[model samples]
Structure formats: structure tokens, C-alpha cells
Target: MNTITDTSIESITIEAADPDATREFLAAAFGLGGRIRVRRSEAPTTGFRGFTVSLIVAQPSTVHSLVGTALAAGAVEIKPVAKSMWGVGGTVQAPDGTVWKVATSAKKDTGPATREVEKVVILLGAEDVGASKRFYLDRGFTVDKSFGSYVEFETPGSPIGLGLYRRRALAKDAGVDESGSGSHRVVISGPAGTDPDGFAWEPNPSEQ
Candidate 1:
């Protein structure tokens, strides 16, 4: 799949220890509309998973609403909703151990709270951000933006967005220690197979 051109992650399949509970939690909390799939797996995963799925929305109210629903749906709050230099957001660990970031760029409420998600971003924590960025580019992923330690891929029309950041920095952003061993416990679809950073990928089922 090295020649993959004009690509985006169609969806991600999370290998859950408790598929049923995880599915229910996801449905009630974020209503991912099946973009997040689950299957049973006992793979050992601890601490940070080297990745996070971020929900970017239009306003702070949506962030509050989403975070509140996530907590009510059995997610453990990793960070309380608060304003940051970037905007407003928070973190939560799903019942199945997936770290999720709910965020918005707007500082104030645009209107009433609504469960609307503007984008679903999958950010991979890469050991060598520059190398990984180059790897993805060689695989035909368009660069939306890039800086010293971060790269965002152009994923137009994709249900799941893609980006890469320095591993240590990513952990800091997630408010977690950067020490963890074992599987990431998830597989995504963009370019099939694993990348240099060990992020797993499979053929997008939707394209089958």
C-alpha cells in the first residue's frame, strides 16, 4: 500500500477487553455512529496507548456536553474541562481503555449545547515525528500542516482525521506519563499494515 494516494483513515477498530460495555459506552457518550468498531482482545495494554482520538467541535458548550455525557456513560475523567491556550477541552478514558480528547477552538458558547462533532482526529505519538511525517508523505498522504514536532495530514471527506506528534509531547498533552509497554490495542485504516512508528493499519472495511 505504499502507493496509496489521496487517503484518509476511514475508521478505527478498537480491540476491547469488554466489547459490549465499550460499545454501549461509546454509543451513549459520543454517538460515534459506528466509526469506532470493537472486537474482543486480551492484549496487554497499560498506561498511554501512544494515541488519542480527539473530538473537535464548534464551541465550548459542546465540549462540556460531550465530556459530561462521557463521564455519565462510565468514562473516567482524566482532565476537567478548562480553557487552554488553544481553546477549551478535556480528557477521558473510555471504559475500554481508549483515551479520548473532547475539544473546541471557540472560547465561548456559540449557541445552546449540542452533541455535534466537527471532526474525529486520530493523533499518533511517534518516536520520531519528522521521520513519521516523511513516511506518511511518501505513502501519498497530503500534508495539511507541519511544524517542528507536529504534522497534520489532509484528510478531506474522512470520518477520522490523522496527525502525528512527538511521543513525549503527545503524552504531556494527554496529561499522562510517557512510559508504557504493550500493544496500542487499536487498528486504523489509511495505509494498510503498520507504520514505522508501530501504529497498526488494516484495509478500510468500508472500501471492501
Candidate 2:
């Protein structure tokens, strides 16, 4: 197995019908740095192809506030803020139709655990979970957990966690339509450059 040397998710690129609007919405909601890249697509995209970008905050209190901020910034509520066994979380759809899940752990912790924006998790819905998992595993992502329909990978030294899920199930969880085609509308970057699963990283001058 090839061990991936660099695990950090340097940035995410998105293809959108209105790149500027999507970029503005994301910036306003998450206060993203230059890490997010957006490009305008000549045609409309369809399908449950896009990935879910999760922001894990240190404080549970920040969850609701962040959800509200996203709503005010033109994100439609997909799942309302609620506490579950896992933690507090809510789902929303950005103006460009990207799904986002904002959450934090339910259990209280000490010290730095109370900080905001604990980590960013990228969950890609795959047409074939097993194949996708194998693709990532071959590229050096350690298996964190796995089940029949889902598998998560640990990106060491990275504030990002990557996962693969069944496309239809993911769409259902996000309260969105499972029928979409065209562009996946997502990009992931790391030191490895690209993966067998078809995610690629483009050179960013800002990061150089």
C-alpha cells in the first residue's frame, strides 16, 4: 500500500453556476480564508454528486450561531439545529446548492476543545462505497471506521477528516434530492496532488 505522505486538505475547489455568489455565501458563512476556490460552470449541474463539507466546532454553543449565520447568508435550512447522541448539528444548502453540515461534540471537554472550528470534514458520496474506500485506502488514508454504507479515513496531521458514503443515502441524510447529474461541484487538495477516486488538486498561487 502506498502511504500518503501529506494528509492536510490544503483547499477545496467548487464549480458553480454562479461562482461569485457561491464564494460570497461561503465566505460570509464560514469565514473561509483563501482555501476555497470557485469557478463558474458554463452549464447547470445536476445530481447528488457534490460533497458535504462539515465544520466541527469546539464549542456546542457555536453550532446554533453558525447555523443561523449560514441561514442569514442565503443558505436554506436542510436540517434544523438539534442535539443528538453524536452532538449538536444542523444542515443547510448554500445558494449554489452545496450541502454543509455544522456540528460539534455533545460531550463537554476541557481546554482547547472549546475552541471554534475544530476541524473540517469532507464527505464524498460515492456511487460505489467499496470501490471508493479502496481507492482512498490505496492512497494512504488510514481507515478510521467503516460499515456497510460508509467509511471514514483519518488524515494524520490534518484538521480535515475524509469519508465516503453511498450517494443516495447521503442525499437523504442531507434532506436533498438524490437525482442530480453533471458536475460534482467539489475539489480536494493535499500534498499527494490527486487520488484514484478522481479528486484532483490544482496549483494555487496564493498558497505558493
Candidate 3:
């Protein structure tokens, strides 16, 4: 059995065909902080095939603002802003092929939710949901919710929620090609500082 430790995603590294452009888009759209690292890659990227980076906001207004910002930054809208079972949300694809979902929970609805951003979720599209679920479970992530082909896990003291979804299905939902190839442009970290399931880890230089 693998011992679990307090873990959190340190950063998500995106290998973009045009790193500077990708970085500018992200900054303009989401005001991406130091947590996101963008690097140039000559190697072809399959684009956002099997993953979504979600921004959880405190209110519906923020969701609208984020969606608009993404569009202004050259993102293609996959889903327009609308009310869903969870709350009001929308989806967009970044120029670098990264899919982003901006949403807020209905529970926070109180005569107009505030515009404060809450959390970020990195949802990974796994070739095998069960295998990916187990990989994180063994590494000490506690399951928050689980259903067929979908699972959500939360790390201790980490605001980010990691999720696993069926790859082809996720790609279909994002309105993107189901082809899974090239660098995934993602990174996860934890207190253990150990790589599981062949995931790479780069310690935060500032934290060191």
C-alpha cells in the first residue's frame, strides 16, 4: 500500500507551439499567476485532447467575465454561458489548444454571487479512468465524488480538485479531436515529492 501525504498541484506546464502567445492569452484571459508555466516546444502538441483546466469563481458574474475574457484572447467557445445543474458556466479553448471551463457553484448563490475567484481544478482525461483513479488514490488523494467514467479527488489542504474522466468522452465534450498524443502540458505535486504513474515533478524554486 502506498502511503498518502498532503499533496497539491504545484504548477501546470503547457508546451505551446508559441509559448509567448500562449502566455499572453492566458494572462489576458485568466490573469494566470506564477503557478502556470508556459514553454516553447518545437515538438507538435496534440492540443487539448484529454484535459480541462477549470476556474471556480464565487459568482455567476465572474463566470461571464471570464468567458468573455477568453473570447477576447482568441479562445473558441465550446459552450456558451448558461445555467447548468451545477451553476452558471461556460467553456473555451485557448489558442494553444488548452480547454478551460469557468464556473461557479449554485450553493453560493445569494441574491448575486460575488466576483471573487475561489479555486482551480485540473481535470485530466485518462485513457483508463479506473487506473488513473487508483494512481491518485494510492498517493493519498481522498475521493470527493466518484461515478462511472468520472471521479473527483481532493488533496489535503489543497484548494485544487483533481478529476479523472474517460479520455474520448472528455474530448468529445470539449468539441475537440479525440486524438490523444504529444505532451499533455500538465504537472501535479504533493508533499511526498515522489513521482507516481510516471508524472514529472519540479520543485517550486521559491518554495525551496
Candidate 4:
């Protein structure tokens, strides 16, 4: 009955000649205005030399607009930004060719499970899990489970989960190599009684 497989867009990577300049410009233009992590990477001896990848808080409803504006300003659009039926997302590419994507989330709670799930978790992969944990923890994220190769942040009233893990393992899980360095975007949905899937909110008491 199903023909297409694996339709969700998880992550992406891009190459930039001047990663720092591009990062600063993008952060300002997109109003990311959050704690950003910068890492120096080598290899892929073609497009990138020294670069920075920024991970910002993303919500599903406005993820597309956030990325679209940045891409339109200075970032190049590699993949056409779009949303999915299950309320996930895929928006990648930025100026300097740095890749960024809005976070994608799981399907609706179709089971008899009531109680109204308010949020979802987002997971990311990093080379140094410990360092990354400290980085996020310093930025006001409530860190949990510090023994494994991964770390998670519990953000409620969202559709996607927020987490970080080992880059090699993350790439392996996604069937990709972890040698390249670039920005990635992710989106999480909003709480109930709100526009979880829809956007452009006003004072809509009827929808609420």
C-alpha cells in the first residue's frame, strides 16, 4: 500500500568559505539570538576550512519562516523548504553554503494514550558529548542522563524532542558520514489549544 519510504527530513550539512562571517551574519539576520556552539573542523578539502554550526531553538509552526527568511537574505537555498503530513519539517541551506534545517517531529498520538502530550524531544550528535552537555547546560537546558554517549534536554509543550549525542553514532544512525561540519536546523511543535500545525497566529478564540 505504501510506495515512498523514509520521508522525514532529519538533518543536513553545508560548506562555507568564510564560516565565521557567515555565521555572524546569519545569526543576526535570522534572529537566532541564542547560545551558539562553534567548532573547528578539517577535511572535505574543497568548500569549507574553518566554520561554525549554530543550533537554535526551533518550533514547527514558525520553523519554515525562520529558515526561509535567512535563506532569502544571504543563505543559499539547497533544499526547497517544506512540511509533511505528519507535522514534521525539512528546511536546509544558508549563506556560505552552510546547511540548516528546521526540526522534524513524530506523528500524532494515535494510540488510546490520553493525558495530552505537550512536548516532543529533539536529538543532535556532537563529537564531544561531555563538552556539548556542559555547553547546553550552561545555556539553561536541564541536562539528564550523563553516562551514555548521548545527552537529552527536556523541553515541554513541544512536538519534537531536544537532545544531543555522539556525531559518529548519529551519522551512522542516519546512514551518513560524520566528518563534515555545517549548520543544521530543527523544529518542535507547540502546545495544545494552539496552532501546532498551522501558522500566522492572531487572537483566534474560536481556534483556541
Candidate 5:
């Protein structure tokens, strides 16, 4: 089914048990530039929520800065920051059960650590990458790249970009197990609906 295809990602709502504390953590840790929101929800959820929010920054310093702050804010380190063929990055799981990955394409430090974030990509774990890609295409999203088990959608000017990855692969990448049930405990505000993989969304409050 065609979910939110042509929509712009205004923000993401992280359904949290303690909204106040979670909000504070996100603000102090990632400072995602107002791209994240939180609401109280006791919905049963466990393991990997089948999604992860990524902080795509410009330099390695920024990666260290963001990940360091996240760790200091009580986020558990899932993967240590280090350089790889794809650049330097690492993963962490927030106290609220949300997985976050901080990464940069630059291997070398560019000047000093800055709070500047180049982009944020919401990666949804998909059962079938091709099927999900078609769903988005039918709805209206243009493909930036689609190869093997990954598909990235072009979302120019949007606060958050979208991508699809195999569920198991996504969980492995986040250093978690692909075993989650109950509500995802997260909502994509701009899309305002549920996708094929049971990923949920809600209308952008600003648009409403």
C-alpha cells in the first residue's frame, strides 16, 4: 500500500514512558534541531523497535561530539566510534529504548567539533526492500538509490530523510536483536500513517 509518499518529514514523535525526561535527553544529547518530539506512551515494546534514527554529520569530530554527549546523557554504548571503509561511526541505545547511530563521511577531523548536523535519516527495518520501495514509489517518493537490501528516498528540504533496510540487517547494524513486539513506540509525524512493515506515523501537527 502507498503510505506517505510525497510528504515532507517535518518531525518524528518518540512515544516515551516519561516524556519529560526523554525530551530532555534528546535535547541535551543530539540537539536534533527540533526534528524530534516525544509523547507519553506505555505501549508494550521490546528488543529492537525495527527502526533507528541516525545523525549524519559532516566530520568525525561531530560524530564524537554527538555520541559522547549521548553516552554522557545515559545512552548505552552499543558500538564504539571508529573509522571504517564507510567512514567513522557508532551506535547507541537511549534509555528510552530508541536506537541512535552517529556517523560522518569524513574520516579526518575537520577543524573542531561543531554542533552542526548535516542530515537525519530515519531508517525503517523492512521485510522486503523491493516491496517497500515500490510502496513509496507508488505514493510519490523518488528513489535516490536502491541496491540489494537498501533503498533511500530523496527528500530535499525535509527535516528528515527516509530509507529502508532489511530488518535483520538493521538490527545487526544497531547491535540489537530483531525481536520486537507491541507498538513501535515511535511515530513518523509527516507521513501520519502506518507503512507495510507496521511502522507508524501521524499527521504533522503544523500541517494540521
Candidate 6:
């Protein structure tokens, strides 16, 4: 995936009972209510670019915990918890019911240890070493030391070494077939033409 520095937003989604609540949640979250409108609704609705809404609920107790959390945060509750046609859930009045989801999830974290892992430098493949350097330089990226034929670019807060590699070579390192020279081309876009390609990725607004 090509990631740009200062890319603003990528996607927006909403989920709610009244559509209006979804929109209002998004409005408060992104502060884009006055300008962009791209929400798709079965009824009257609204949308915002780079927004995504995902609604998931499990047991009634789980839903209550989520609702309680929201209420504790001073969020206005619209309805009491009850069993709906779908399952147990409740509707909350938001600035835009049609914008974002105001529900809880039935998921858990049963994975590995939650130890911190920093920096996610994207690996870009390049053909010409000098040309690739020049391309990145022209785009304002400061190149790290050149290792053999491969070159590196710095992305703030990235934990690993982010660099440009020979497509075939990197593929071999990752145990992927990279025999074809022109197999892949990774583009690192920056804001405007001045912003350098940085390796910072934030949480998607819709998920938040």
C-alpha cells in the first residue's frame, strides 16, 4: 500500500439506527460536517470521505458496558437497552444518527503478548539505485546510507529500517519469487510535492 505523509484522511464509515446519529458522531469526530457529505444510507443519511462505521454487538451485558462507558463520558443516551430484531442493542442520539456507529463489539484480544512494537517502515522496491534516490530526494525524503545496491529512507516513529530494495533481492529475502525485474513498483506519495514520505500511520477515524 502506498502511504503519503500528511495524507489527512483515507476513508469514513458510519453505522447507526437513525442515520442521523451516525452522521453526528462523525461530525463530532472529524469536524467535517459542514463541507463533505458522502454517507450512504437506506433512509435519509449523510456521509464523509475517509470515514467508516462498523457496528457489532454481542450479549446484552456487553452492550450495556459499552453504553455505560459512553454515558460516563457524558454522551447522551437516547434509548434503554432492549432486545431488537437483530439482537440486544440500544439507540443513542448523536449529532448525526446517520454518521457513525454507537455500539459495542463482541471481540476479544486472545493473541500474543501486547508488547510495544514501534515504527512500520514500508519497503519500496526500486530498479535504478541512483534514479530512485533522486526520485525520493526530489520528493524531499532524506536517504539513509546506501547498502550495496539498496537505499533507505527515514520515516519518523518507525521502528524498523525502511528502505528501497531491489525487487528481486527483497523478494528473495522474504522468500517470494522476484525473478522478474519489473515485477513491482512501490510509490511513496507525499502531501503536495514538498512533503517528504514519512512512515507514520494513525488509527482510522471510523474505527476510533
Please list the residue runs of candidate 4 whose C-alpha ends up more than 4 Å from where it truly belongs after superposition.
1-24, 27-29, 34-61, 82-86, 96-98, 104-150, 154-162, 169-177, 181-208
lDDT of each: 0.87, 0.75, 0.73, 0.42, 0.87, 0.40
Q: Which residue pairs show collisions in model 2?
A: 46-180, 46-181, 47-180, 47-181
Candidate 3 lowest-lDDT run of ten = 190-199
Q: Which ranges of candidate 1 are over 4 A from the true structure?
A: 1-6
lDDT of 3 by residue, 87-170 (tens): 888889898888998888763455663445678787787777887777777766788898888888865565456787787877
Cα deviation of 196 in candidate 1 (Å)? 1.0
lDDT of 4 at 38: 30
Candidate 3: regions farther than 4 A off: 1-6, 107-115, 190-199
Off by over 4 Å in 2: 1-6, 107-115, 191-208
Q: Of 3 and 6, which scores higher on lDDT? A: 3
**C-alpha TM-scores of all predictions:** 0.95, 0.83, 0.83, 0.39, 0.96, 0.35
Error of 4 at 124 (Å): 6.0
Model 5, which residues run further than 4 Å from truth? Answer: 1-5
Question: Model 4 reaches what TM-score against the true structure?
Answer: 0.39
lDDT per residue for candidate 5 within 1-208, as digits (tens), equals: 4367455888888999999999889988988756988999999887789999998999998998999999999999999999999999999999999999999989998687797888889999999888877877877889898888988999888999999999999998888889988888888876555788888877787877
What lDDT is reached at residue 165 by model 1?
88
Greater-lDDT candidate between 3 and 5: 5
TM-score leaderboard ranking: 5, 1, 2, 3, 4, 6
